[model samples]
Target: MIGVLIFPDFQILDASGPISVFEIAGRYAKSPASIRLIAAEPGPVRSSSGVEMLARKFGSPSAITTLVIAGGDGVEAAARNPCTLSFVRAVAKRGTRVASVCSGTFILAEAGLLDGRRATTHWVRTRQFLATYPAVKLEPDQIFVRDGSIWSSAGITAGIDLALAMVAEDHGEEIVQKTARQLVLYHRRSGGQSQFSSLLELKAPTGRFGPLLTWAREHLGTRLTVADLADRAGMSARHFTRAFVAETGTTPSKAIERLRIEVARSRVQSSSEAIERVAEATGFRDPERMRRAFIRAFGQPPQSLRRSARAG
Candidate 1:
């Protein structure tokens, strides 16, 4: 059985994302592994987003073969708690295969479970992690790191990638591909795949141009010219240019390209659609144009990113 122990104020995806992958793996594996959600307590646990989930609490480590401790804000305080730290130490003593997601590293390191082990956590939390757990060898660049049976992931979304790798380890390549397809996720994102997508969070501009930015996201497929956008917003080109830059950190042309890159990243992960087809659908005139835009934003051609998704 593969067991995950979640704590209070856990990141939602830190639990849900990995489960989505393993649930599919359970169906296709030669010998299905049981997946369980174990919490520190039996009652409802609140997530970072205020979503609540009821979980089975295990005060002691069970006979489960694989154990994962998920991360969140409650982790810092939990790591310091005698009960939580003792529970973690006991689990490690049983030779359980232990792993952590994002900030969950705190609890494991606190219990001395990660001493001299290669691990990772959310990139934004690296400084705190280093300060708290100096014995662990923390690698900031990886999406996930595995040293022997102990595994750790960088952040919430990366947990899914780590879970897929675990599935691959248990069932082999074909089963991992099937699971990825079922979950609509990447097969094996290289541990190096980035945590941030500046394009995905492309913040909408405010003030008079706010509505215009919304209109643009809705109309990315059209041949949108600055003149056309200005006309739609009922502003002169000169005034709109200054205001647009002030509102969004980018210009009109760059924003459209960034939006398109975000769309392309999703398509590459979820579909076997041809690159050229994706380029056209997302408003690129041709593959070359898309290549230029992709390189400027992602530092690699679109195909390279797609290749990383399939790299084991």
Candidate 2:
């Protein structure tokens, strides 16, 4: 049985997304998989979105093949609960495949289930999570990570991706493909894909600089410097540099490089454009420079990523 653990103020999609994947996969499998919603306290549990779900007591059936913990605003409190931590620890000790969605990793960490293990959480919580759990090998850039029996994912929808991977493991690629089709997901994103999209990361700045970042994306083929961006934003170079960093959590050069990489990667993966042309079009005039940037950003060169994309 696949069991999803929920607590008060848990994110609704964190549980439901994975549940849907499992449910759909079960339909196409020879033997259907059983699913259950569980909680420390058995009853109607309110989600962070204000939706309520009926959850069975955690120990009601006493056995589960896989146990997924949902994450949300209440994770800090849930992490502190002795009952919740103990329950997670006990289940993991029994060799059950244990996983956490987004902030739910805090609960597993508190229970000492993720100590010295490679794990990932929502990208937004990367810094705090690293500072809090110094023992965990946190890969904040990954969409999901699996270490031994413990699994973790980046954010809400990533839980669905993690679930699809689990289904693929238990069933097969064909089963997961069918499940993905039913769910209308474009494709099952690989775990190695980045958590941060170039456009999304740049649009993170909510201030006056937000529109400027969008403009930068549109003109990636040209050289973009702090001075150039400052002129566009109508600010002095020094002030623009400080403001850009303050608003975007990144320097102007880094932001430009990210934008270029995004466009370059998209072209590489989706088009038959030559690597040199892609580099020039994305403002990395030097093919070698683009290769290095790709290596830095994705742990692989452009050609390698292109090959992997094609193979997939």
Index of the highest-TM-score prediction: 2
Per residue, candidate 2 scores C-alpha lDDT tens digits across 286-309 of 999999888777778999989999
Q: What TM-score fits each model?
A: 0.63, 0.71
Q: Which stretches of candidate 2 lie over 4 Å from their true place?
A: 60-62, 190-257, 263-275, 280-312
Once fitted onto the true fold, the runs of candidate 1 whose alpha carbons sit more than 4 angstroms away are 30-32, 191-312
Itemize residue pairs with steric clashes in candidate 2: none
RMSD of 1: 11.7
In terms of TM-score, how similar is model 2 to the real structure?
Answer: 0.71
Residue 41 lDDT, candidate 1, scale 0-100 = 76
Predicted structure with the largest lDDT when compared to the true one = 2
Query: Scored by Cα lDDT, where does model 1 land?
Result: 0.75
Q: How far out, in Å, is residue 248 in model 1?
A: 24
